[model samples]
Target: MLAIGAAVLFAIAFLINAADMSTNDVFTSTNVMLIGLALLALHVAGIGNGWAGRRRR
Candidate 1:
């Protein structure tokens, strides 16, 4: 599930950032962590419910 994926991503980012609290971490940990949060927001907004489904006339 996308939520699970996002959770994993967030966790990984946290680990990376924690391991190297520097501005030059290889993974861009802050960015990745923000991305994960965005994913979580999407999932919370019901991304799985076919928000893009076209209305049937």
Candidate 2:
């Protein structure tokens, strides 16, 4: 859930940043997008699996 939340928050940030790209710069927008994407990947792969669960042998 935490990861999902982080991913959502980051995505929002990315969207906002993207919208302001013209006022800002390309690097900032690209960095925000990259971070958001990374968080989203972690959310789907880790948090979605229940982070505290045990693994099989």
Candidate 3:
């Protein structure tokens, strides 16, 4: 799920950059892309896998 969210964020950033759209400093393409990368890292680290059950032994 977090990976999916990151993908969406990446797409949004790409579009914003490709279209040459102007945005606030906080919402700039680079910031959005960085946020997406953070989310991707979290996903890779299993931060939001949605599975909290103990492993079977």
Q: Which candidate has the top score in lDDT? A: 3
Candidate 2 has a TM-score of 0.42
* Residue 34 local lDDT, model 3: 98
Q: All models: lDDT?
A: 0.79, 0.64, 0.97
Number of the predicted model whose TM-score against the real structure is largest: 3
Runs with alpha carbons beyond 4 Å of true place in candidate 2? 1-27, 48-57
lDDT of each residue in 1-57, candidate 2, tens digit only: 646666666776677776764545644656665766776777667656665767999
Clashing residue pairs in candidate 1 (N, C-alpha, C atoms within 3 angstroms): none
TM-score of model 3 relative to the true fold? Answer: 0.89
**After superposition, candidate 3 runs with Cα above 4 Å error:** 54-57
TM-score for every candidate vs. truth?
A: 0.65, 0.42, 0.89
What's the best-to-worst order under lDDT?
Answer: 3, 1, 2
In candidate 1 the C-alpha lDDT for residue 44 amounts to 92
lDDT of 1 by residue, 1-57 (tens): 668878999888888778875655545888888888888888898886455768988
